[model samples]
Target: MIATAREVKDRVIAALNDHDTEVVMQYFARDAVYVGPVGPAEGREQIAWYFEHLLQAFPDLQITPWCKVPACDPAVSAVSEYVMTGTHLGPLLLPGGSMLEATGQRIAVRGAGLCTIENGLIVSDRDYYDQLELFSQLGLCLPEAVA
Candidate 1:
């Protein structure tokens, strides 16, 4: 059976919040493109590396999807609203090129995402969140918003 874009994205989001890199990667194609605050990760390996770093930074990362908006022909594209909660316990490079050391701060932030699916596989994913809010929650200083 073929899966819908929403289904694919739902599973992907769940896997992401679980911090299971392999499960999260299954939703994307080998050559998939992922764009987030940090930058673009082109290819599965890069995506895996990104998530590995992310999980390392936030071992308790959790994402809650508030909504899913579907559009485009065949409904292969979707916009999802989400809220995230995590604790900073490891070094992480912010989107703005700043490195943050372990602050052991807990943070919760709201965000949105966009993704395009093809043949039930994620072709592209774009994530948008407020980096400033994250920094503030972490008690860290940032010159600007990371995303």
Candidate 2:
């Protein structure tokens, strides 16, 4: 039997918490698109790369879903609010082609996600989070503008 949207979302979350990239990729369609803080990753390969990078950066990363909106009859979508906690033990890639070295800082960031499921597989997943908040937790600061 085909899994419902909630089932798929729960399974995906479990896989992510397990830090099993391969297992997480299973719930995504071949052409799935995942848009996260960095940007949009198209296809399973790109999405897998994104997860791998995240896991490498935070080997002990944990995701806790606090709230979930019920899926309707069609069960094509799922929305959830979650918190991700981990330690910065590995290099983190920045948007401007720069890399942030490991700071050994523990971070807890709240975020939300919307998953679009098709045939029990995720076709598209968009994650929303505060980049500034993440950076602040990592002890990073933006330079003040000069007049």
Candidate 3:
């Protein structure tokens, strides 16, 4: 049976909720591509590795979807925008051979994701989020002045 977009969307959210690397990996196609704020990554192994590292670096990370749209086919694809909130309570490797100290600071970021499912697995995934928000939370920048 073809996978409905709703199923795909639900599974994606469920995976995040589980915060289990194996569970999240189960939803991806073997050759799926993932694009996030950091950059593009391909294949299940790479995506799993990235997620695992992220989970280690931010143990309290959670993502919540704000808007969801199922494709016309109700299968194969969908787009979802989300808000991610987490605390920095572990080492975050940065440039210059330095790791940022965990400030226990909370961060909320806006992000958008596009996913394509084929053969009941997500064959492609793409996401975009605010880098500035991360920088600001890390004490690298002053909060932007409101208009």
Cα lDDT tens digits, model 3, 1-147, are: 766756876777777767877888888889999988777779998998778866766888888998888866557888888988888887776535477778888888898888888888988888888878886886776557999
Best by lDDT: 2
Give the number of the best model, judged by TM-score.
2
Clashes of 3: 0
Ten-residue region with minimum lDDT total, candidate 1: 68-77
Write down the TM-score of every candidate.
0.90, 0.96, 0.85
Per residue, candidate 1 scores C-alpha lDDT tens digits across 1-147 of 668778888898889877889999999999999998878999999989988998898999999998878856436888889998889999889755778898999989888988888888999999888878887898877567778
Winner on TM-score (1 vs 3): 1
Which stretch of 10 consecutive residues in model 3 shows the poorest summed lDDT? 92-101
lDDT of each: 0.87, 0.91, 0.80
**Model 3 misplaced regions, further than 4 Å:** 93-99, 142-147
Ranking by TM-score: 2, 1, 3
Of candidates 2 and 1, the better by lDDT: 2
